[model samples]
Target: METEKKFEPRIVAMLCNWCSYAGADLAGVSRLQYPPNIRVIRVMCSGTVSPHHIVHAFQRGADGVLIAGCHIGDCHYIRGNYMTIKRAKFMEGLLNFAGYSPERLRLEWISAAEGVKFAEVVREFTEKIRTLGPAPSFEASPRLATAVL
Candidate 1:
């Protein structure tokens, strides 16, 4: 009997440079253990992560997308995280309307000093993505469908 291969989800993480990115760097320097599934893209602010970027990641085979920024009232650019929060909600609703599972997208606020929290967030989100499996867009791509057939 053959054992089934486990599915490993690919996660795209967009981290704000001021806080989330620094937190992730700290996590790395601290040697904190977290899932190795994330591919991080550091942005100046989470507010800069547009809906197009999120859709593009899904189209390009990312199983999930995570947007992380500084905590409320602590943004390097005043009110940047507020914009992030609003955008994330709009994106989630839009994705759901477009036949995608909104759960595949996540948003978090991590301060520069929260290395452990960064690791824990990555671990938890990775597990959630694993449970959700691949993004529907990936599975439904015409190229992938033809190849599978």
Candidate 2:
């Protein structure tokens, strides 16, 4: 008899260096266990994560993308997370309109002191992505059909 392998989600996490990244680090230091599927990319600020980067992640086969920043009013760059939230929301709308499942993208505010929350968020996001399964290839997506290429 042949054994069937289970599917594991590929998650890309973009974390702000001053807060969300610190939280992730703390999660490790605290020995908190989370799914090993997530690949973390440390950014100077969440605001630096552009829509291009988000789309590129999906294009590169990320089943889900998570952008985590500092809590509102606590950004190391003053107004960085504000821009991040706005862009993420906009991308959600765009993705929905582009025949893509907006649920694939998630944005969260994580503070340096919230290591437990970080682990919880990763676990939840991983489960969600697993349920969604693999995403359609980006080139075949309707959103890119009209592009000049």
Candidate 3:
């Protein structure tokens, strides 16, 4: 018997309410073509998304995480995206040091009017993650297992 493999990557998307979330909703309403792998969580601002959320997603078996926010100087909160960018950069290094692919965590700027761009971004990011294969974050380390036991 041939075993069928699931090709869809599990994507966790943290979208800023003022921009990226609206963009994603527009993508759906406009019937834009894209992968269905992305599961979006709307936040008041991207700055609300912490490294802990990304780490938790990884531990729960998400293959990729995308954080979408407003463009620089366009933040609804006057500087929330700046914090988002800095925090995401720091998290990238931390995740990489912890043996995870930093590429799996992406930060992007998507405006509410850019539905097509949102769809395209999702498609592109999903494909890149597929090529990178599944993340090993779900696999318990020896020390972690010992602690559990």
Candidate 4:
């Protein structure tokens, strides 16, 4: 009998440099164990991650996308995380309207000191994505294209 290969979900993580990225770095330095399913993109601020970027990641076959930044009232750039919160909501709605599962997108706040939290978040999200299996749109329409610009 042939053995079936396990499916591993691909995740795109957009992390804010001032906080979430630092937290991820801390997680690494702490030698925390987590699934190696995510490809992280470090941005100056989570607020700077545009909807276009998120959608583009999905278009490129990402099974899940994580947007992490500083906690509320703790943005390095005052009011930046506020914008992140607002945009995340809008993006969730837009993605849902586009026939994608909103659950595939997650928004979280991870402070620079929260290394364990970072690892936990990644582990939880990875498991969630694994349970959801591959993204429906990516599987149904492998050649779907959109102009992100």
The estimated TM-scores of all candidates read 0.89, 0.92, 0.91, 0.90
Minimum summed lDDT over a 10-residue window in model 3 is located at 134-143
Q: What is the lDDT of residue 106 in candidate 3?
A: 98
What does candidate 1's lDDT look like per residue over 1-149, in tens digits?
99999899999999999999999999999999999999999999999998889989999999999999999999999998888899899999998897889999999999999999999999999999888886775445678667868
lDDT tens digits by residue: candidate 4, 1-149:
99999999999999999999999999999999999999999999999999889988998899999999999989999989898899889988988897889999999999999999999999999999999998875544434545332
**Candidate 4: worst-modelled 10 consecutive residues by lDDT:** 140-149
Tell me how far the alpha carbon of residue 32 in candidate 1 is from the true structure, in angstroms, after superposition: 0.8
Comparing 1 with 2 on TM-score, the higher-scoring candidate is 2
lDDT of 3 by residue, 1-149 (tens): 99989777999999999999999989989999998899989999999998889889999999999999999999999998999989999999988897788999999999999999999999999999999988775665798877878
Q: What are the clash counts of all predictions, listed in order?
A: 0, 0, 0, 0
RMSD of 3: 2.9
lDDT of each: 0.93, 0.94, 0.93, 0.93
> Candidate 2 on 1-149: residue-level lDDT in tens?
99888889999999999999999999999999999999999999999999999999998889999999999999998998899999999999999998899999999999999999999999999999888888877766666666746
lDDT of 1 at 105: 93
State candidate 2's TM-score: 0.92
Residue 45's lDDT in candidate 4 = 94
